[model samples]
Target: MMQCYGKSRVLTPTVVAAAAFALNKNRSLRTQSEEVGALDSWKKLWDTGMTRWHQRDVYWVLQKYGDDYIHKESRVLVPLCGKTVDLAYLTTKAKEVIGVEGVLQAVKEFMQENPNLQMEAVGSRNGFDCFRGEKIWLLCGNFFHFGPAVAGKFDVIWDRAAMVAINPSDREEYVQVLGSVLKPGGVLLLSGYVRPKGDVKSGPPFTLNKDQVLHLFEHQPWVASVECIESVNDAFSNEAWYKRLILRWRFGGVVSEDIWAIHSKAK
Candidate 1:
């Protein structure tokens, strides 16, 4: 059997528990050893820095159609959603947002930004801080730990800094796991830089080739629409300056193939 855990000592019971829960729901993952380690490292390095990826314009871009496409009181799931500014957009559009981030620091910072939020500590595989807002509740924990108790149907998924987070191998599993949360017909908007292998050195802050991305989700029966918006930036570093593609994928939940496809024709 392949060793499931990485060499990082930071892997704790909380992390493993989250992994176990996620594993129980889905059986596909394409992550490499170093990539997983970098993700673990990236979570530890989070701070309230303005340069954080969550602060980028992608948040608003992802939510642009929300006013027309999404409904109120609809639950939205954000996986690997670390202090994602995108969560702010979902506030008025949806009833609750369950942001599954591996880091507690990001959750704390998110609470700090929204001081009016009444937050309560909750326990799970890796721990979670649930923020209750008048219209939104930001649940902090790894998405994997999001128990089956989260049964309400979500209208859309805001996947901003999520899919770009893992190594290339793991991207497929990321989609399936994330896709599992939304109710049929939910819209999924994913925006992030796709680093070609030549450019990226260190990342969570990582990379994904366009083809690999599309192949992961191309076949989902429920995907009604797919649109890709490509952008170029020096945000992380010039060496890794990339033309990113934002994939706006819609799931009608009508798939014979449980495996979701990127529907690149949206490009």
Candidate 2:
């Protein structure tokens, strides 16, 4: 069992907005624009104690799928992991766990939350501070700077809130980096939101439509297929609907060849 991060506190919308404004000058409204989106906005949210997105327990989607696909001794990677309790939960099940977070403060809070676990600075790589232990490794740096060489490859990838929380412009790069570290035939479990048509512009919790999800991985040779799609409830997407997208990577794939063969037969 892992140590709990204590109870969660509720914050008002006005307070959250005020903090965003006072803390980050780049973003004026609730969230940042895709092009001008800054990581400093998230850092401000963490420093100001406005992290309402943090969950009290394990995420519902993970609770539903982890046991079925993520087996014992499986290596797991959680990106942009901001003091997420899910990291600790994974440590209980997986042989090795790696968490990459852009904010240094979030990693510090996570270590403070788990006093029982021992953590030490392993070294610096790709301009990020890396910490390692027997079961877990936490890297404090830009998530994009991390790759297979920095963090090694993993069997499973968990995106509890990472994908939805990032800027739209960065989404493609995010997926690319994720694929680079994932082993062949690895599984990617994602939790995202589908909001009303206009709500996509209003986000740090960006709304992701089914078409967008499909299009994101449509031509990727690494993605074998989307295995499952399901609906669930989440605090961030309460007004909307939360969706889970499970993608399985191909092992020694020839997807391009298959596509070419089909097209040739049509001529």
Candidate 3:
């Protein structure tokens, strides 16, 4: 395991209980070790290459709707950015791009792969290890530790899978943190997955329905509006049970959608 500057603590009961519930839905049980450690569990997933969620290229959301909303020379923020190649892509269009990641291994791998980045360590800020370059800044630490003072304001926030990956218990605070860093009238490009009410447990790729999305945004005063630009009923996995459930729940089947909503932070 890669050494993290920050200490790893046992997962809180709330988070463990949530994880256990999700695990139970899949008919699996977590060992005592897995139950106690949140960071280690995620670190193990990345270390073992279990990161199927990691996209090879920039997300479809950016390809499709980014140009429409994100202006050239804008400052863009990517939350929970897992060394996705999208960071490099963003640098081409944006004047500056900031990415926040929790894992040290992901940060190291990203820097190692992208040799073009003229990176220099900027030391720590609010507990995050910070690095800066010509067009990019990579912060390695817990995303929750990032504050407006540390992260500064941004004109664009590319929230691909970050929201869904968070534990439900922390979502409201997560949303608040997001709102704080965004400059007023900034663009927030968001996307995630949703599914029919099934026997399956909740997930890191958590189910986020349209209504839930609306509710989440509306509650935040900074969010001016949420226009769900696209939605489609789609397949989840190749599992036999998953396929059958899609057919059974035809009216409200499982699906993943790209949300290209334009959020204007309150002026």
Candidate 4:
């Protein structure tokens, strides 16, 4: 991602290499023109699409979990939250909710929509300002920056679309960060799409099968038990598709770990 830090834009090594490859598309301007087009496409379409998707609601998860999810005033953490409706869910049950987002556009829109929310930009290490209200706050920064010092702490971490949104190569990092941010006995209501548009070989809409999803959190010692809630079947282009897995991880993983959601429920 090309990020604007100070006066100039900083490109991660992956971004730079990707840009190089994109530039080689056309014989005329070749790689250079391709890179510009690719980046423009990402900013205009792909990234914007992500922001919009997250901004929608999470009523599906809420209906499933119901009130047992948490009580009023419980603190919750939403990582790479984007401009999501889950914040609304959090505010109702929890006293405060902290949301993290990398893109600037999404955060800006969120702040505007929730005008009652107060914001104070933080220093470099923690990323953006603190948007404080009776129940909402957003730390518009990278997902990896959760942990104790930055976010203080939280009793629940809701990870709906975040894990799959990350590159497969970065799954471990994502798990490590989640473990660090969540409390020892905290709960994680995780949800994500699977078998999403098979053509999505390159994406933020990456999908994961049951085996792969389990593998992500298995190595982490802090997580207790990983259990599946449900699977959503979706249809795309006349192809029957499997979209999501709703999971629960408790006390870092609950002592009597019971997993294997797909084998038991998914057909």
Using TM-score as the measure, which candidate wins? 3
TM-score of 2: 0.73
Query: What tens digits encode model 2's per-residue C-alpha lDDT throughout 205-230?
Result: 67765556666654454555553345
- Candidate 4, residue 150: Cα displacement in angstroms equals 0.2
- Give the Cα lDDT of each candidate: 0.51, 0.64, 0.70, 0.55
User: What TM-score does candidate 3 get on C-alpha atoms?
Assistant: 0.76
Whole-structure CA lDDT of model 2: 0.64
lDDT, candidate 1, 89-207, per-residue tens: 66756777667766767877877776655555544433456656555565655554354455344666766656656665556556656555656556676655544434433455455
Minimum summed lDDT over a 10-residue window in model 1 is located at 250-259
lDDT of 4 by residue, 45-98 (tens): 535463334434454566556466667756788887767767866787777888
Q: What is the lDDT of residue 115 in candidate 2?
A: 67
What ranges in model 3 sit over 4 Å off?
Answer: 1-36, 198-201, 235-254
Each model's number of backbone clashes? Answer: 14, 0, 0, 14
Write model 3 residue lDDT over 120-141, tens digit each, in one string: 7889987889988769999987
